[model samples]
Target: MDLLKKKIQDEGKVLSESVLKVDSFLNHQIDPILMQKIGEEFAARFADAGITKILTIESSGIAPATMTGLVLGVPVIFARKRKSLTLTDHLYSAEVYSFTKKETSEISVSKDFITSDDVVLMMDDFLANGQAALGLLSIAEQAKAKVAGVGIVIEKGFQNGSSQIRERGFNVESLAIIESLADGQVTFKEEVVSR
Candidate 1:
């Protein structure tokens, strides 16, 4: 995970006190090798969780989730934000509010993809306020699926997101935990802050 932290340090842009843009090599433009390594790491961490499926939200979470699925030899299911004509019925849905986008979206997944017999692992590119993770958890609840754990690629540890998930009695593994993004500086959770 040091490689990922280093990548963020090298290319990540702290746009504001709460916003860090990593579109250069993560969400927008992806590094396949890095993504593969991320997948391997996640697989290793959750190798004993009896994971049957990988769940992620649309757009940003796809790449990392797909790679994790590939490495774990499991199918990845991404919740679609936009509604499609075919995604009309037998779906598990939840209301998710995006902290970065400042918007709410109804994320849905097909019931055919998930079941009560499956153990799901929620994966995301980033975790801020835990809204998206909560949404996925809601969907999993509706499906009566067991949650393996939550895998976050880059977590804003300064936020209450990770704590919220932990409070719910689920394991959360974040590869790169950013303690703060203040004054246009990136601070990892491991580094002590005097202030």
Candidate 2:
């Protein structure tokens, strides 16, 4: 996790009081080594969960989730932001409003990949408004699956997302938790937030 926090310190850009863009190495252009470390960290954190599958949203979350799935030896399932022609039926869907993009998108997952017997571990690049996490949780709920927990690469600790998910009794493990992104500076949380 120290490596991840350092990466954020070095490459992350603070666009506003609320937005810290880490697209350089996390989302748009990925660093395989960093992602592998992230995978190892997540796997270590959730090692006792008995996870059967990993669920994440498309685009940003794929890289980290896939890496996590690889480490945990579980299948990864990503919810598509836009439904394709090949994916026409038996989909579990939910609306996720992005605070960063300022848009509400419907994310969907196929029922074929998930079932009630599975223990799901959800992962995401960031946790801001709790929408993406909630959407993934909803999809897992639709499948009647037991969620092991959520794994976040970067958590905006100033935001309500972490508390919201925790209020529902879901464990959240974030590699780097930013306490503030104010005045063009990135401030990480001084205290540890345990799962």
Candidate 1 structure lDDT: 0.91
How high is the lDDT of residue 101 in model 2?
Answer: 80
TM-score of each: 0.93, 0.94
Q: Once model 2 is optimally superposed onto the true structure by TM-score, how far is the C-alpha of residue 174 displaced, in angstroms?
A: 0.6
State each model's CA lDDT, in order. 0.91, 0.91
Candidate 2 lDDT at 143 equals 94
lDDT (Cα, 0-100) at 98 in candidate 1 = 72
Off by over 4 Å in 2: 83-88, 193-195
Question: Any residue pairs clashing in model 1, and if so which?
Answer: none
lDDT of 2 by residue, 70-163 (tens): 9999999988896333455789988888766877888998889999999999999999889999999999999999999999999999999999
